[model samples]
Target: MHPNKLRAFWAARQGLLECDTHLSPETVLEQTGWARSVGGVGPYLTLFTRAGLTRPAIDRAVAQLQIHELPSARGCTYVVPRSDFALALRCSQGFGDAAEVQTAKKHLGVTDAELDRLGRNVLDALAGGALDPAALKDRLGDLVRNLGPEGKKRGVTTTLPLVLGSLQTAGEIRRQPIGGRLDQQRYAYARWADSPLPEFTLDAAAADVELARHFFRWSGPASLAHFQAFSGLGVKASKAAVAPLGLLPVSADSPLLALPEDLDALRAFVPPETPVYRLVASVDALLLLRRDLALLLDPADVPRVQQIGGLQDLPSHAIVDRGRLVGLWEYDPEREDIAWTSFVRPDAALRAEVERTAAMIREHLGDARSFSLDSPESRKPRIAALRAG
Candidate 1:
């Protein structure tokens, strides 16, 4: 890496960590850059918040880091973790794409004309604090079914899944099982955060502060727009939230930003070209480093790995060698095994490093056995289908 590129990489990586998604440090790791970089959400969040990150910047930063497939409509009818519902409700107000509009209508079960009305209803529910999806289900059930044919087709049914996906994007909810046969669409909800509503105000004080600091440390040679994209706080708000966290003023006045202390520490490491190993998640912090993923992957191979269907199809697990993504890994949760399938051939050193990582994963999933991909069907991650919305 050139001296300048090294500075930029450091800033970009750390900046991603600082994004405010309100996820536990562990969850954030699973969602952001350098997945499993540390142990324990407590210390990670403490260090992150202490460093400087406002809630909104943190959220936007995290958002910018993910490569998502639009969620499936039927299984995604409800959002998990209430805060996501609030954020999605807010984020969706201005979006008017044809597909977006159509999806919204299908989920809500309403007609074209009823789109605005349904939107208002979703917003109303959000404002009123109907945080639970189950509760929302009961409250909106009548409205959803009452929409006319097109209303049913366009309004409630369509909008329901869209809302769910948006909420998931905002990191406020997740999809989980409700009940029924293993293959049925019987899905319900599970809350991940204490705050069910999106705190528009967190763009300033609160957890947002911690998030910003994380980003500054991880991703310095970065722009506010990049930060905003990563955190999901929107550009202007991301800038404002990040403003108070001062910068190190590195020599070139490059767009890069760094924490004063880290600047001193970085001085010790080989500037810009240090070899560091990283395991990043699909939604990891580095995703926000560049708007287009091709910065890290070949365009031809991207769709095959990042198809948005599941972890297996995408390079959800990747190895970052000296700040560049070099290979991919995937886990079979049921078998508790890690499979390393590298795109590039590995020499002895890289192979050894990969094996060591596999060992670490096995240790992390204690009591679980490691199995080859040829392991029985029971050893594979189970694929479950849910009933229609």
Candidate 2:
């Protein structure tokens, strides 16, 4: 874990995730910059956007990465860039608002009544600024009509979940623990949905296994348990999915196992002397291998971080150096900016490195500077919530 290796790992991980190319596992493996850390689709979007790729093209690229499919009565499928609900809503309305909600209704084929209900949901989301899955489920309870004849139909509400499932199958929307009630336990959000899918298919155990292989390739040298965690697959399915990947059995030593490429990149990026970065936990949801969060974060920090500024703070789309998160990044629409935050008692050498990383993030963003992250004035309501939390 020399500094050079750490640097290389971050470079490769960041590069591959930032790439807009439609990469199969083989192609991704061949890329020196590809890391085994891109299970979530959000960072993938940044990679593609930074590379000047469009959303549709990215979807095609993700589809090319698929190795399996699932079957479901709803014809539901799962993949990376899991759900585009937010993006779909954005595509329809450009941002959050009642008008956007209306557009989303049309996009989902829901009726005016449904749209109104949806509008209320969207408005509430904007006001709250983050959706706590369980809270939202409670909030929306008695409202969700399951698909069927009496209270259900093959209409928008019914199809909505399938659409979300398709994104999940595609690696567009990822499933993560929310520590909420069962119904709210699995809520959906999107950071990678810009990569729109033309279809979604279910992932049977076999398909799940194949997909797990893809997960490992992008984030491996990881354990079978890690693979299952990353892919949300059962042990049998996960093992089966990756069995065909031809993984090299290099050694039984090393606590931090990684794919050879990841290992090599890690060697290049993780400096043994100093690996300190203040990474946003939620961003880890889209970056760190789902199964290996403990490696990067203190177990105790997870919940507090997840509940606090976690959801409201737009995903911190920046890379961690050594292990310290040194950059601040944002994707306000098309522009992606990563500002180098002041370090805690940074030495000259570290400052120089931070500047270099910040420059790279800025270069990737180009002229898109519509968003700014200057601490906002303490508004009455937010101040109240801040104190409350």
Candidate 3:
């Protein structure tokens, strides 16, 4: 495949160019794959840009338990649809807790026995109803032990998070943004009345295979390296996980693999001739899932990529045309306008897209954060850099 054509193909597959009237947030997730939610607006923008889902609609879905953020593959939180919650939580099982547990044990003198006791306390506390972190901590009193200086140095701070994380991984409780919004990090804990882990029949290995299927279908023609990176399944497990999928290569010597059912469609797919502009979050699956931005760039843009930050990341939220990344964007809250710089010359279509997305952000989202710490003040440098371009 021609390089640009390949990029556009990825764009189409990501639901950027081929927008659809997906009836619900979960339906969009089912089609476009899970939206990465890093205490940011990526999930909302992803649903809006791809499925035309509004903020009110998405909030309603969350309020009604249609979709939610869950720790899944690689132990990263993704805004998952209701249908995949069990699969997501199942895949997350041992993966999410290993590192955190190890760090707590080594640095804060944490023990499995200590966590077991705290876990029970946490469950009992939430049995009555949900509680935000402060309230939960206050309710637990000294039961949620403070680790003092050593813990503070290592960023562990307290035993509360350790138990909370362990319990969440074990599916005893769920973390919800205080007001059920995806953008902020303040979370409340609630007992999952119908916890999926209890009913999830798939064991660890089977769950890994299921997640691998999702990875391929969402970002197919993706390399095995991509799957390994996303799953964090290490060498042998990652290979074993995808081995059952019967994935095929794009060419005789191609590194990329796709599901068997998708080969014909991949071959027949065509890049859009007219400019199809899309403004999306930095962590949108189109880039983050593959984590190989260099592959998405035109050869001419290589030097510019180096000048900015290189292939692994973008300096700001992406401005994509068809499937190819053409520019970078940031929302200027003061002006209530989108500030962007493009690899291609600024065109009417691109500006129009900026306006449309800006309008949506102003009226509905209020802001588009790259991650939890992102703010208007921090965005100035990137916006200035874009304006300078």
Candidate 4:
């Protein structure tokens, strides 16, 4: 398929094109895949850019148990809808404790029996009420054993993190931001009144198969390698996962795969004649899901990507037209404006989209930090580069 047509099909399927006013953030996430959350405003951008949802509405959904961040595929966190909570937790499995516990054992000689005991204590601490890490650690006292110098060197300062993580992935506890916002990471862990796992009936293999179903729907016309990478399921499990889904090739000689239901729709789809503009977060599913940057760019725009660096990844948040990337942008706090540079020549429509996104930032989402640690000082270089362009 032509790149123009290809991008539009992806954009519409990902809910980046014309949106209906009635759609909710939970519906947006269910229709598309979950929003990737990294203690940043990407989830806010993902919902607003697609469905015109406001920050308060998304935050309300978070508070009401309509959506939440959890350890999903690859043990990375994503803001998944309530309907998917069970599936997401099922996909996360052992990966939640894969690293920290192993390192603690290697460095501080921590044992599973010890960790198991600590997990119970952590749960007991939260049973009284939700508590931030500092407060919980204080309450945990001797139960939260310090790993000392050697453990700090290995990044396992205490037993608290290891147990808290294990309990969270196991669906016994949840982390909520203290401010009731999704854009920051200062969290209070609380015991779930109703855990998501007991309601999920699938076993391990069944969970993978179900995940493959969502994966292909979320990122069809994608490669087997793409699924493998997103899943982090390794070779044998990934093959087993997709096998039952009846994934098919777009053409006999083509290397791409698609869900059985999407092929006819993709064939019938047409790119809109007029540009449909949006400014999306760097981690938005449209870019991060299938992750083929060159395919989403026009040949004319290729140089703009090179101007920053190479196709390894985007240097900043993007300005998109019907899913094709037309520009790169970042928030400039000093000016209270969106700092942007376009790959295509700026037109009235494009400029309007930029200002609209800028004002939306000021009104609802606030800063556009890609992650929690990102700050205005750290963004100076990229802001300058966009200005230079």
Candidate 5:
């Protein structure tokens, strides 16, 4: 497939071209597999930009347990829909490698049996009701009080994280938002209610296959290595998972793969001649779906996008023009403003569109004050040149 066409197709698949009214926040998450929630804000911005969901609606969904934040692929926290929670968690089981276990043991100075005991204690504490981390730590008392000097150095009062991490991966418990804010990271621990969790009994192989299917549906025209990297599955496992789907190869040079059903659509895709712009979140799906940098960015601008010696250090948020990355943007909470820098000199029409987008951002920010056009250090020269004109 042509790279530009592939980009446009991806944009459409990501729900960037148009937001469907039928697509709820939960459905959006299910379709996209998961939204990055490491910083807590990414998932909210992602849903807002892609699904055209308002902050109140997203918060209500999360508060009602319609969507959940949990550990999943790549062992990172993701905002996953409740429907896929069980499967997502089940697939993440055994995700904590031996190295992590050993590190936990060394830090907490706890044996396997002791860790098991702690896990049991934690479950017992939360059996009655939800409890935030501080309350849970107090409830456990001496059991987790002294997590050794190593744990203290790490600024943890207890080794509850070690046990809780294991339980979360095993689908025993989950994190619930402390407040109604989408950007809030404070959470309370609650039992993983079997009533809400899906009962689809797919074995590891079947589950991995289903996961691969979802990955392709949302992030197709990708390579096997991309799946492996995103899913954190081994090369052999990744190949096995995607094999049953019968994906078609895009080309020999790229060796990209796509779902059979999407082949015709991919072939029919065409990049828009008119300039289109979108202000995307830091870990947006369109940017995260593929691993290859060359496909998304120009070779000359690669250095500006990535860090020294790092192949994949993208900006916190991107300013995309049509299917190409044209700039970067970030929000300053203190200043209540949007700070942006552009790589391309946008014409009057594009500039007006950008201003309209800024207005949308400002309105969505609720009480935020203003917007600015100052460039970061990396793009200072570019901004200066644009102004010099």
Candidate 6:
């Protein structure tokens, strides 16, 4: 498929272009295959942008267990709908737990037996009521007090987090919100009481098939490599998973894969003639769809977009125009404004679009005073120069 057509198809599929606001926040999350929230606020911002959801609504859904946060695909935490939790949890098995355990062992000198004992104790501690990290640690003080010199050297506080993660991975406990804010990361531990996790007997191959199906349904016109990259499933496993789906190619020459049902719609997709702007969150799904920076960013601007230390660092969240990333933006809490910088020179029309998008962002954030392209740092004279012109 043509790049623009593919981009439009992706935009539409991800609910960026035409959102179904009638659907509940839970439905939107499930349909989109879960929203990444490792940054704490990503999932809430994603729903606001894509589903037209408000922070209050999101908080309600989460509090009611209509949706939940869990470590899923690639072992990153995601806010997934409660109904799809089992499938997401099942698909994430054996992905990153071993490495985490090894790191804990090396740094904290925690052994498997210790972890097992701690896991059981943690369940008992939470059996009566939910407890936040600090409270849980206080309750488990006697249990984890003897993590040894290594734990002290690495900071003994790390032991509880490790144990909590272990129990979560084992599906013995889950995270519960501790505050009213949707963006708040404060969580208490609770038993996974909504429903029991699926047993291993539920056909691994079938689970993989369902996982691939859900991914492509929301993120189609993608490649097997994209699926592998996003889901962290191995090449052999990814191929086997997608094999039964009978996904269709976007074009004879393109490596992109699409669901057979979507082929006609994708072929007919047209990129909008007018500029379409969206303030996407850092590590948003659309940006994460492909790692090739050139596809989303202007080649010349790539160097400017990399994080301060290196290219491996996360790119700042972006403002996208017609599927092309045109600028970087972030919410500066102290200033209560959306700070931004455009990489490309804006035409009259694009400038108007940017202004309108900035207004929308400010209103959505409620307390945001304004949007500014000027850098907060005095040393960055170049950014100020861009703002002046």
TM-score of each: 0.46, 0.40, 0.97, 0.97, 0.86, 0.83
Ten-residue segment with the worst summed lDDT in candidate 6? Answer: 367-376
Supply candidate 5's per-residue lDDT for 326: 71
Which rank order by lDDT, best down to worst?
4, 3, 5, 6, 1, 2
Which stretches of candidate 1 lie above 4 Å from their native place?
1-143, 146-187, 190-211, 218-220, 233-235, 248-253, 271-279, 289-316, 329-345, 356-389
CA shift of 26, model 5, Å? 1.5
Q: Who is ahead in lDDT, 1 or 4?
A: 4
Say which prediction, candidate 3 or candidate 6, comes out ahead on lDDT: 3
Model 2 lDDT, residue 318, Cα:
39
Find the 10 residues in a row with the least total lDDT in model 3. Answer: 91-100
Give per-residue lDDT, candidate 4, residue 215.
Answer: 82
lDDT of 6 at 292: 49
lDDT tens per residue, model 2, 70-135:
211112222223232222212211112233334435554446665346445533542543344445
**Predictions in order: lDDT:** 0.42, 0.38, 0.86, 0.86, 0.71, 0.69
C-alpha lDDT of candidate 5 relative to the true structure: 0.71
Residue pairs in candidate 5 whose N, alpha carbon or C atoms collide under 3 angstroms: 282-316
Our tally of clashes for model 6 stands at 0
User: Per-residue lDDT tens digits of candidate 5, residues 1-389?
Assistant: 55667777777777776656577899988776588775445676677667677677888898887887877776767788988887777677667533455676776566898778888999999999999988998998878746667767755446677788888877778777777654556788888767333566888788899889989998868889888988889989999999999999876666789998888788777767776677776567777767555577656767766642244545346677655677766555444455566777767755665565556556664321111222244444433443343
Which scores better on lDDT, 3 or 5?
3
Cα shift from native, residue 252, model 5 (Å): 3.2
lDDT of 1 by residue, 165-279 (tens): 4454444554443321111233443333533345554422334444566556555445665666545566666766677787655557556556777566555544334334444
